[model samples]
Target: MTQMTRALMTAIGATLDLGCDAIPSPGPGEVLIRVAVCGVCHSDVHIVDGDWGAPPMMPLIPGHEVVGEVIGLGAGVTAPAIGTTVGVAWNGGACGHCRACLEGEETICAQSEGTGYSRPGGYADHIVARAAFVVVLPRDIDAARFAPVLCAGVTTYRGLKRAALKPGAHVAIIGCGGLGQMAVQYCRAMGFRPIAVDLDPGKLELATRLGAVATVQADETDVPQKLRDIAGEAGLRAAVVVAPAPSAFTQAIAAISPGGAVIFIALPAKTRDYLPISISDMANHEKRLIGSNVGTRVDLLEAVELALTAGILADIETLPLQNANEALDRLRQGRVPGRLVLTMA
Candidate 1:
């Protein structure tokens, strides 16, 4: 058994605590990772504000966009050789016996485990992850640059996949922030012409540069009508809401064309923030409302390949682990441009 000294930053009752601890070796089917960088996701901000019901276990190491080196492997693990660069995401593990898992929809499995939320994750020196769940990354990509791809990238990709839009179809993406930016890039790479919607002009401009053919200012009173005018009477084939606002859901529903799928990948700070969905409207228009979690392990692998092959990457900022609290603060304050990451040096 290998025990190594590690310095970790933990979430303690809405505050961050930096401390030194010893990390244990991996157990069977697990791989020990020497973390190089971990991305700061908006979900981490919500957890800090106690938005997800009861507080998580004290001293929770919160981070899901993890990139690291496979330092040690437990029994029966092969491939992803020791020292391989790999990534872990929001999903940690799932019960393969469940119907959802058996059907390859493990992201929605009843016994699904989340990295930062359900268990200890990145934001530390090392993490022991399920070998089957870790994604092997290209050694050439910088760890900090690709960290967010493990979470934000895969999430939006899966969200778009759920829509199952035809190639080259027009798809509207609401919210042009971290996740939304990735959504725009993925939309283009997947062959969909993306219409970006956001209240922030700067973000909209960024989205346009990233491949969005159209941009809508969300603050406009006639968001739905404006969307229709831009998308035309034929309507959109799909819409993805990456903005963590209930209003974004309502806007997506109203703007969707007939038979369009509205995929939601973001959770608002509170359930109360969710908008009312009229049952009649859904049946009349046949608009599909879809909920997409982070995505399955296979999706994560494909997303990594997409990033490496298509050059779809998020804008990221790197900071030391000690600045974890400051990074969370910036995310909550909406100051971060794309993604903020904590480097474990």
Candidate 2:
């Protein structure tokens, strides 16, 4: 590896620039990963575009879904030995004293620090991650595919768990993008009938190929009634909304059955602008509206286990680290088909 590492920075005012910086040493309770691949996710775009209000940490190395080998460890580090492969996710570190963390909701800890947002992330050749926040993985797993399991996998998995759908129940996955695609696969793995709903024909087709029992073209068909018809006696047990659009949430809600849940995983830039919920409908049906952030360490373990055991992975394309800005631009413009992975080599 180069002495001066390469990093992509989200510069002031949301512009991205690449530069060389001195490699950082791990702090106490931290581990330094020799980053093999960094999975570029929509959340990075949001951070670059100033979507989550002000930047949590300015001029950031914006990447969170990280997979690499542990080459260095800080004081008190034991497991995830040097040369071991691991993944760093969205939640970088959390304050264990917070109520949320105490209750095992580390993802929602008041002092939770985001990987790319609050600290340097895997856009570089080497990144320092909190040992408690990283996931130990098998050395032989596919780097490109497993990298996405750090973020997209765990997020959707937590969304499914929020739904609490029973086996053989009918579930709806809204939007067939990176997150939605994984949601459909997980839905099928959990023994549920996955009904994929998407505006794009290509995305819907991909969802079908990924084990969705049925598909709904959002631009053409009626979402609620079509879902109800397909669900039959199961009556739409749960709905996982992975689209960043406001309409997706409403459609997911419309498709849900009595006592079912709508688990929201996407954070649309204008999400607060236009969300229409019916109090009467929610009350009458006993439906739930749940918002899921990234997952905890326990959740990450389960997600990776599922990914390793069930052949679940993202459809990936690779880019050199130098093209990080271009990759972010393409993602923002909706040009990339699936997840875009950045290679540190």
Candidate 3:
């Protein structure tokens, strides 16, 4: 086996060099994985453009939705076999002793290490990951197809799970992008009446194909009123805002019926500290607004299983790792019709 691993490095703004190499060795409780497919996420753009918190060590490797096979295990790592297929998600590892980790919410751990942002992520041909943070993939699913579930699918899945909706409840999904598409499928599988809202008619059409019961184009006048009409008649239970538009939150708040919850899953390019909804509205209507980040390890596993069971696979355009820059450009320009994934040979 070759000792050197080839990786794509973001040397600076929008520039990637393909010659970077790393010889990674797993430490105690960690493993080295030979990456098969790494799903490109919107978060990568934030990291590359320095829009997110801070750049992860300059010349960073960014890719978190990774599906690979364990090639070597570090000392004290006993769960995954050498050839076991696993996924490395956004949450690379967390300090198990933290209060959040202790409560089974390690995704919010203060010391949690993010896969691409905080550490060397999956853009490389191989990566070192904490064994505990990896989820073993099922043998029945194609590895490439399962890649996006690690982040996008799991994020939407966790949002719905947190919503705590009962069967037959009206659930609205705003934005039919990668995450919103997954949300529609999961909501349908969970027996919720899935309603999709988006400005793009193509995306709405895709959402319908993915099992959404209704579609609302944001360009329509009185869109929120239409959502409210639907929710009021059907008894709205919750809404998940997968769209990053700050204005969408206000529309979601208006559409949700009394006691309905709205979960914001997207991180906008810029932060808006406050929503347009007044405190009185929340209190009087008994409405709840919550924010969810990428999911936990357990959520990743469940997301994979749900995707496999419901055939809720992501519609992706696969590109070679060499074309990563092109893929990122397309994603940044909003030209990508679906998720873009990078494949490694």
Best by lDDT: 2
Taking the candidates one at a time, how many backbone clashes does each contain?
A: 0, 0, 0
Ordering by lDDT: 2, 1, 3
RMSD (CA, angstroms), candidate 2: 1.4
Clashing pairs in 3: none
Best by TM-score: 2
Q: Which stretches of candidate 1 lie over 4 Å from their true place?
A: 1-12, 55-57
- For candidate 2, write residues 1-345 as lDDT tens digits: 446455555454455667788778888999988899999999888887777766678678889999999999999998778999899999899999888989999988888999998988888898999998889888898999888889999998988887777889898888888888888888877678899988788888889899999998888568889999999986998888888788889988888899999998888776565787999999999999988898998889988888888899898889989888888889888886778999986
Regions of model 3 farther than 4 Å from truth = 3-12, 271-273
Q: Stretches of candidate 2 above 4 Å error? A: 10-13
TM-score of each: 0.94, 0.97, 0.95
* Model 3 lDDT per residue over 233-289, tens place: 766678899888888888888888888999989888766635567888899999988
User: For candidate 1, lDDT tens digit of each residue in 1-345?
Assistant: 344323333444356777666786788889989988999999887776677864445556778999999988999988579989889999899998898998999998988888877777798878989998999887777888788888999999998888888887788899888998999999988999899999899999999999999999888888888777777766787889888788888888988888899998888766556589989889998999888888998888888888888898778889998888889889878998889988987
Number of residue pairs clashing in candidate 1, backbone atoms closer than 3 angstroms, sequence gap of 3 or more or interchain: 0
Question: Where is the poorest 10-residue window by lDDT in model 2?
Answer: 4-13
Which stretch of 10 consecutive residues in model 1 shows the poorest summed lDDT?
A: 4-13
